[model samples]
Target: MKNFNWTNIRLFLIVGVAVFLYSFSGIRNEGRKIKQAEVVFVDNENFITKKDVNKLLKQNFDTVTGIKKVQLDLNKVEKSIDTNPMVDKAEVYATIDGKLTAIVVQKKPVARIFSGSKSYYLDYKGNEMPLSESETARVPLVSGSIDRTDKKRLSELLNYIYDDDFLKKNITGLAVMPWGDIMMDIRGYDFEVVFGKPINIDRKFKNYKAFLQDAIKDTLTENYKTINLKFTQQVVGTKK
Candidate 1:
């Protein structure tokens, strides 16, 4: 007869009990009520507030407290939060302590476009964002009858303008003429600049910088009504 190994049987029984307890604990926790919710914004930009997030959560996942974990549609709640125009991203999750958490990211606007049908903002990702009455983003303003086809180039131009501190501060408005020409309105100047198309941006800006440096030295910036950048070799000036 083979000797019975009591140690092996004891070890197996202990492991089985541990696993059973762990599974029971998980089942109990799953049925536990959700205690509270926490809404956290990624940054303090205030483009979307905690109050706004709570309001949205209330709309989709109302009073989740006292409700079981398996009952809440977390994916649907996240999708609902993401549907807001101002929100760029939303992450929803439930903690082991029965607390729900949502992290939201707001869209950052690059420029404000004044279209004929509506006024909207162009975000950093080149998407249209609706203007908020509570907050005003001081970005470059693109004013004119800008068609949908022209928005991409115009957004690129605005992003370039935004990248330069001098341009962002001095160039206030961009007007797209009916003939497809782009004119930039300079701040504190009576005249406008004809920036032409969106080609050879580096060369054009370099020429423009040199011309501006010389013009400022000669105190002739106010003398010209338009500074043309259409030509490759020369910065043309049409005097008032």
Candidate 2:
């Protein structure tokens, strides 16, 4: 009897079994109908819901319910879901055990815009998001002849405000002047902060903060009518 190479033989057997099982599973699942479909959002604070996903799926893949797993085109299904303006990313896949899964991520809105002609949210990526009646996002409100052209600098300002806890809580309104100066309205104070353009934006904010720090000690914030940040390295306050 020839001495057997047990290692080689064992490897071959393992590979052969794996191949056989894969082929068998594929064959067995081919005619089996898709049992379930699950849709999940990547984040807890989401604009889109499972019901919306279901509606989209039904609209795009009407025959998916009774179709065999092998017949489903996951790529096409994903593309359909991704068409929604609210969706930032979408992934669709099917498992051999007769279940299809979809994972979706919704766009994040940083600011809301009330332009003359229309109203929408400017997402972090500067894309337009239709204002939601179901839920309202707590973000800075921008008004005054704004359009998509202002999205970049607008996004930057919103980001700065949101990043700072004090600014996020106190600043409620933002307005753009005709000559391109940006104005912000504080929640409690009646005055508006004139933030001219975005030049030296960080320094302007620093100066504003310094002024506030000093004003709080003497209660001067209430008397100031306007805090102009257009001048170099200063926050010029006008009396009421």
Candidate 3:
């Protein structure tokens, strides 16, 4: 029992010393001037470039490099980067070796909106993201009388469509009418889909899918000008 206690004490002392040395090294390195600044896109989605991030850092700190690691407000730096429309989130930190690093996650655009002369992207979370000149996202194009108030409802419908394989691949564009009716343009089809008022959404989609399968099987797809899903429990097809 005495030998075991001595062994345990020695092990605890060794661990304590190691931790103390590591902490001391970290404290000393915090005073060291930054040798380099690196912007790492965790998602590899470069909607905002590294140069843009460096420029932002410059605005915040006058200059990033040659500044002491201890002097940097990582929270401030992160907030500055996060304010960028392209960045979804940002984490800024200094490495032990005098390197300042910013990890950024770019927003994922699920749809592009064109309201009047202004155009922007709606990210997966339904937040409005200004279009980036650096990158273009291939997503559903939405036009017509859409306003900010309409986006939440529209985003729900868009998310549903995107989650479905057939809808994601086939539906390309959407037009919102002033009366809150939604019209969609489908791929490889002459018919327009009248998706009316974003209500009974899942049921409407199910009804549309059933209609589509039957129409294709019966060679009736080309006979329609508009496939309407506004009515509950049934699909209404207007003849061309």
Each model's Cα RMSD: 3.2, 2.6, 3.5
| Runs of candidate 1 exceeding 4 Å displacement | 1-25, 217-219
Candidate of highest lDDT: 3
Question: Model 2 compared with the native: what TM-score?
Answer: 0.86
TM-score of each: 0.80, 0.86, 0.84
Full ranking by TM-score: 2, 3, 1
TM-score of 3: 0.84
Show where candidate 2 strays beyond 4 Å: 1-6, 29-32, 147-150
Tens digits of lDDT, candidate 2, 1-240: 999999999999999999999999788888788878899889865577788887877775674577787777778888889988788889998777777889999888778889887888888777889876557889889988564235677788887887789998988988887777888999888888988885676788889988989998998888999999888567899998
List candidate 3 segments past 4 Å from native: 1-23, 147-149
Please give the CA lDDT of all the candidate structures. Answer: 0.83, 0.83, 0.88
C-alpha lDDT (0 to 100) for residue 54 of candidate 3: 92
Better TM-score candidate (1, 2): 2
Indicate the residue-level lDDT of 149 in model 2: 31
**lDDT at 41, model 1:** 83
Residue 59, model 3: Cα distance from true site in angstroms: 2.3
Residue range 16-124, candidate 1, lDDT tens digits:
9999999999898788888998998887667777778788777845566778988888999899899989999899998889998999998888888887868899987
- Per-residue error for 13 in candidate 3, Å, reads 7.1
